[model samples]
Target chain A: MSRSSRTFRGTYFSCMSVQSVSRILAVAFCLVSACTPQQEPDQEPQVRILELQVPANFPEPEKVMAGYPLSEEGVELGRKLFYDTRLSGSNTISCASCHQQQLAFTDGVALNKGAAGTPLLRHSPGLANLAWMNGTFWDGGAKNLESQAFGPITAPDEMNQNLQELVSELTAVPDYVASFRLIFQDEIKPAYIARALAQFQRTLISANSRYDKYVRQEPGGKMSELELKGLTLVQQKCGSCHAGDLFTDNGYHNNGLDSDFSNHSYEGIFQGRYRITHHPADVGKFKTPTLRNVLVTAPYMHDGRFATLEEVLRHYSQGIRASPTVAAAVMQGAEGVAGIPLSVEEKQAIIAFLETLTDYEFIQNEKFSSPFN
Target chain B: MYRIRRSGFYVAMLAILFLAACKEEKEGPAATTSVTVSFQHVVGSEPLQLDEVIYTSPAGDSYAVSNFKYFVSNVKLISSAGEQIYVEPESYHLIAQDGKTSFELKEVPAGTYQRLELSLGIDEELNHRIDHLGDLDPSNEMVWDWDTGYKFLTLVGTYTGQTRSGGLVFHIGGDTNYRTLALELPQPLNPRQDGSSQVLLQANVNELFQGPNLIDFDVMNSSGHGSGPSLIAENYTSGFITVLEAK
Candidate 1:
């Protein structure tokens, strides 16, 4: 193929010629032939509809395919954009820099540094089943996935990329220009970039864990007695917050991580949901994360303070600090002692059950892997 | 799925049917005109000279405005016969001090309009998404990425207060802070078919700090991401903008 035909530049020149010819023909046709009043601006581009299926074992997505419907081409374009480091200011970091497919999307670190080498205030959370979530981030500030992508991509501490500059850079690449025009039917813009990313992130579904198989009674679904006991204990203790089959109620709760929220630094990063809502009762409250692939997505909590599941369980059992907004369920412990009292063996059993929650299939899935690789 | 257009014969027939259906309910003259609303920014009686002129606020604070940008949307013109003509498709506009000062309400029914109603900010439905293009584009820096909303008004400058003096930033946004301004035109606007009429609107910058809540720059110099936006929104009701003339 000629280089001209390979790029959208060729299409642009052809379109201009087509418009000139149509204008001349329009006048001539008006004199000779009857012309239709319906004016077709341009030929409609082809797009294939992709229906997103919810797993039978999982609940219906809280926001199931509403705005910006999914398309096969759009999702493929999104996957490429998700791994493209061109999104960052220095062209050194992408969304995949922190959200790796192997680690179930999280960066397996307490606090991942940004493209600028500054330590981010919060830990990178795993991205799976995000379609079921109403809000994103620790504070639930961003309303949806499309809006959430902007926070990291534009934040000076994160990607540090100027959105207009990013658009210009993307426009330079013919492949991106063609794909974006085909998918969005408009020139490359930040809103379309975010929509494409959200579409790809929504496809990061991780529901094939052993626990999920056990619940669905699928093959290889057997669990050890200790794991079953741990599952029961989790249902009794941690189920209120990390509630249903998705392993999260998707609600904000003050899990008694800190007593003092005086840290107004970075626009009240330590204050949690209160920073967004400004409600006094929401101080130190963070969104409940799904426990799927918890074994690999280590360094738990919003700040990633706990390194192991054992430490997380210990925090719930003994290390829960007293706060004004401590969850009512956690405060329902025996005789004013906050948190669910778990013995050493119970903690071990819970860890084993959490191991069952890890979906190796999702981590090893080549579909969600980088397009560049 | 992409829509494949029907043959020319079928399209012509469909167009005829559609126009016939639309004509049954419509009683006005079929001709349409455009209305141009122009905004003139000023500090009291003086024309706003961005980054050059220093103006005093109601709180007696001297401030030099470096930037002033705001969104005006959902424009409606109330006709003398009580008919309302709403500007559609692209009603949202970002009026900046340095950028375009006016926008045309296209395809308006040629008639006499006595009042103009327009929202000062984006509606709750469109404001939260931040995915819209043109005017509502997130690249304009009017959007709050972390909070997932648009800043209705942004007035950035330097101020010299009595006790404290530094940068002055009054960024007002949020659903609660979205205010609508209804202006009674000085005279009836008669936009004839195939022609246009201009509505001269004046935006007084000093009114931002001269309302029911007199904003002292020393006390709240840089605020709007929190509870401060609603207080600044109250300033809209106190003659921040007035329809100077309708010609």
Candidate 2:
């Protein structure tokens, strides 16, 4: 063949091969596009619905929730994690097992009974308005609810479940596995589980109390004349440390339950800030808990020694034990070893004032309840 | 044949365009240079030595230093070229009696520095953030865990005098009416080309209690060890940098 004819033939073949490859590529691209899932144009975007209602004076809802941003997925996952019995080693106890809904989220027993039916050292504090609480547990051992959740789960006497095992069990549940993956985006660690629970707990905002309504100037929310007097007394005596909308100042104080407790030094369980600092001065110091739901969360103090609010009032009135750690303000008189002396009328007034802090709306909120139902 | 030549020319043009684009990226801005700043703690015109004799307080309370520890953080270096380099957050260096007082500031651009800004203790924000940096994290030691604030300066010593208390532990750091102190120093430091400079800081432990109403060591050790006076704020403000002679 001539040189031109040979070159022309080669060009023709190359062009045909290139066209064939392009056709093949186009077919593959179309097939891939057809196989991929297509979202419906009319389909609504998946939005998380947080059903919790915020109070009027309770700061901005978004700002309050900054510490714990809630979502439909996170709340659902957290609720499942909360009530899941499989979280415990025996698969018999869940968080709801101790923190029952009917009993104001507190186990009715004077002291919490653990997994092995062992009596807990402290009371199972009611978990109603934990979002406002600076510390958790009666003695204020846990700094935040995130750290507090770990205590019962891993306690030998409590749930008695290992974190690794709990994670494995959670991952085994396909629904939980998918939910956790969605919420955490592949970082499905145990700490995230605690964070989600903390977030859900934070959504448990309790501001619909008679006192809250009274403060907001809402109808049927006005406090009685007696309650007003009691509130004034509270402000004068207890308001220094337990200040602001959230009753507790989030500080540690020696309330002077007793100088000595059944052969154990008051300083031992006073474990206040000492546990964290290992300092001698912090002996017998315990964080001050919020009095928001104090009326329902009875059997007060770190030891749950006082079964009645009356007893707690009386203890402050006359039962203070003197120690070097006792705040100087409290130890003003009585030769440096005395509790604030309150009269019977004053005690009753304080109790009446504390009752106003109880929010019935928080207890009956359906959103904070178990989602399984 | 003309069509073939035209196709070759198009390919050559595409290659040239690719090379031109690559050249722009290769000739970018000059790289950033960094330097290190080393801080040395000196007491009384000399590097603080272990077991050195230093007065406990202004009450003429004298004691040989057994253990002296303080935190230095929030470091900032002002370069001569007008560039400001901030030390990494939560950088805590303990000036112990064992003679490890040097702290190195990394990634500081090579230039002469004019001034060094540092806080003797952790700032208020980091001090209140719980479980932040962990134990031995400068914020932890400098903080008063019980009161929920930082301890600006902690001075512990033994004293023997009428006005001297026994073993004294002065834990100070509170913004309360009588607790916190804020001190600033305007020292001119010429950091070299290597972006490294050593600034000497002297802390007069005695000057801490040299005011007319000097801190009574005995009272400090006794009933007022952790209570009363709230002298930390006053002392830090009055005598933070009594002697700032650069070495």
Q: Report the number of clashing residue pairs per model.
A: 0, 9
The per-prediction i-RMS, to one decimal, reads 12.7, 23.0
lDDT of 1: 0.84
Could you give the C-alpha RMSD of every candidate to the true structure, in order shown? 8.6, 16.7
lDDT of 1 by residue, A112-131 (tens): 99977878989999999988
Every candidate's DockQ is 0.29, 0.02
Q: Provide TM-scores for the models.
A: 0.89, 0.53
Q: Which ranges of candidate 2 are over 4 A from the true structure?
A: A1-54, A58-68, A138-141, A260-270, A328-337, B1-247
What C-alpha lDDT do the candidate models reach, one value each? 0.84, 0.60
Residue B239 error, candidate 1, Å:
0.9
Query: Model 2's DockQ?
Result: 0.02
Pull out the clashing pairs in model 1.
none
Model 1, docking class: acceptable
Report how far off residue A147 is in candidate 1 (Å).
1.2
Question: In DockQ terms, which candidate is top?
Answer: 1
